[model samples]
Target: MGIHIIKMPDIGEGIAEVELVEWHVQPGDTVVEDQVLADVMTDKATVQVPSPVDGKVQALGGKVGEVMAVGSELIRLEVDGPGNAAAGAKQKRPVERTETAAQAEDATAPAPVQERGADAHVATPGPAQVPIKGQAGQVQPAQSQPQVQPAAGAGHAAARPAGEKPLASPAVRKRAWDLGIELQYVPGTGGGGQITHNDLDSYLARGAMGSAAAGRAAGYAPRDDEQAVSVIGLRRKIAEKMQESKRRIPHFTYVEEVDVTELDALRARLNAQWGAERGKLTILPLLARAMVLALRDFPQINARYDDEAGVVTRYGAVHLGIAAQTESGLMVPVLRHAETLDLWACAAEIARLADAARAGRAAREELSGSTITLTSLGALGGVVSTPVINHPEVAIVGVNRMVERPVILGGAVVARKMMNLSSSFDHRVVDGMHAAEFIQTIRGYLECPAMLFVE
Candidate 1:
């Protein structure tokens, strides 16, 4: 029985340190070659590092929320066949998961994973959060105690045992400390007949605590202004990136609204036909196809300007990025060659890319090398947004929700589907006319969806 040490590999562009996010397996659990060992966040990306060889986990690195450098020890393993820890030192590894328990868990970036199993205790939830009863976002008080079963869509909280009264809300019981009261003893009047905050205050008024020891038993209450939090993986990365993009770029933004009635109906029909076999044919794929066609008419919009050289280098092929929200932060995976693919092929490929990005199954190759990017905050509609350009790409297109509004066209009042097309381009390279032209061209393709398919 020998051990193999797994180290963090380079998963992003030009990053040295990675914040340790998660460990998918523990000691004695069988893992195949390419199985994800952990998720890590670097300056450029939040990436999943996979196992290099088939093995059993032996040891893992730091607790959740620890920052580790590239080449840092991640996991120690025991292989079934002939291999040793020292032997793994010379092996080349690519992050891939050979064994999967199910679809990968989608958490914002990976959480600092604690050990798993019968003995494994639950890690407390993040701040501004009460401990959810079982998992995320849902908090219900213990059933044994008299507590309210929340109304539909209402947040429910659980009760604490008699002696261990928490100092926070019923929601804070597991994550923080319970709001100091013997929840079990409190009689109920709320739904499902559970006790609420008033009940606890009533208990306290009726002499619940008499000693400083009782206060200590509750939870440590800090000074009002001081919010103590442990900064980890993706959150830390977001802080760093926001600072970088703001400091470096001299940015400019332009926005316009367009008629998208035809485009919307077209995608809806296509989705109805093929969504089950292929993932839903989203608005994003249609937008990508339109952007590619528009880019062809005004080539300058797709070109990058080198400030130092004072030249614009137009890319020959379109490597378009689709900004997607993931477990980590926003990731823009490239839908390479967006110009060549037909609508269905584009939809299928983008679906695969999004699934890969969400599961952390995306290879390093899938993330980089893009000429331009598109982003949509689905259902989050705000008029005219200024998006930051993904460096090296001269521009990024932002899409807002499509809404139907009344319009007087050809002297007739009628309803039409309308959506705003927002673009952020490098002023240093792209002039306002060129950028507007590009948007107008995209608007035309959207207005006439069949015209986009013709060429």
Candidate 2:
């Protein structure tokens, strides 16, 4: 019998370490070649590690949630015949020793030592070192490494007054300790309810710990009735991106009321004529078409600002991002080349993108590379919203709830369908006056629906 050591392999480009998410096998379990051994997570994606050769599992690389470096020992296995002879030969042969009472009789007698061999075992002096009985019924001493004692009050952040340790990997526990964050308050999203790095990050970002001081000053005790929800996966990604956008970009908002009475009439007529044949027409496509037309007048709004390069690139074609809320989280699916599509085509593309995003099947390309964004809350859109810019993009236009209100037209009171355009821009790149004018351009198109088809 021979032992084979399997090392962690390179999983992807620039992935030096991965967190062990799950293990499919344990010690002594027999596994075949190409069988899955564990599920590891890197770069927010989970990948399964498979065995290369058939063998009986001897030991696992590490516990779940442990971050293991690539090219390190991942698994050890016992296989038939000489397994990886080169590797096995490189292993150290244990040195053996024997003691005799006769030698002790002499005051200066030297201790008798046995020869080093493959069958020999190492020895060390310690109560923790236990003797292992070999196949020949000979007892062999095993060496044990010394354990480091932690200083007093160390890891107090993870300590609980209730005397319960949080379910987390050693690394996560150490990180929480360093940050003075109580793991009891940080929610876990891993299997068996273990805390992950993402959980720690989200907990910190929510300012749950920072609020403690203010609450105490106000004579408020910490609430024990609050439930801890783990922010992980897509939700975690959304939180990080939104936080980054808000932190890096200075946002300026402008709200304008548009009398969309004429635009609504045109959309209804088109839907009645070609809704079944092409696709159902919503206000989104009409808004998108108006924005596309308006972009021609103000091309600066349809561009990306690269803060790192200190430059802005404006595009003639509009790659519009339509924000759709799904079960997973909010996903913005891009409609490429919106400038080329007509009203009907835009509606069809929007429906297709929305369905794909909600079903979680949108391609990577469809989810990114938007020059500008348009978001709407449909029937639930309130009076106004200060929408955040989708970072790097200069502007984002939002559509609010359309309501019929009384307005005077040519000395007569008439009911008009009015909606507000709530838009936000990156103040660093766009001035307040220019941002206002851009919205007015969109307003003109919607107010005069015929102008959208002009050019």
Candidate number with greatest lDDT:
2
Q: What lDDT tens digits, residue by residue, belong to model 2 across residues 1-455?
A: 88887877888668898766567877768999999998665543456789989998876766554567998777777888788644344422211111311222221111111233444322211113334433323343344423222223332333223323346675675555445455655567888677799988876676655643323431232221111234544565577778978998999899999999998999889889988897778888889988988888788899999999999999998999999998767889999999889878888898899999787677666887999999998888999999888888999999999999999999999999999999999999888999999999889889999988885
lDDT of 1: 0.65
Model 1 misplacement above 4 A: 1-17, 24-37, 41-231, 268-280, 305-311
Assess each prediction's global lDDT (C-alpha) against the native: 0.65, 0.72
- Per-candidate TM equals 0.63, 0.58
lDDT of 1 by residue, 170-191 (tens): 3423222233333344445556
Instruction: List per-candidate RMSD values in Å.
Output: 11.1, 18.2
* For model 1, the run of ten residues with the poorest summed lDDT: 128-137
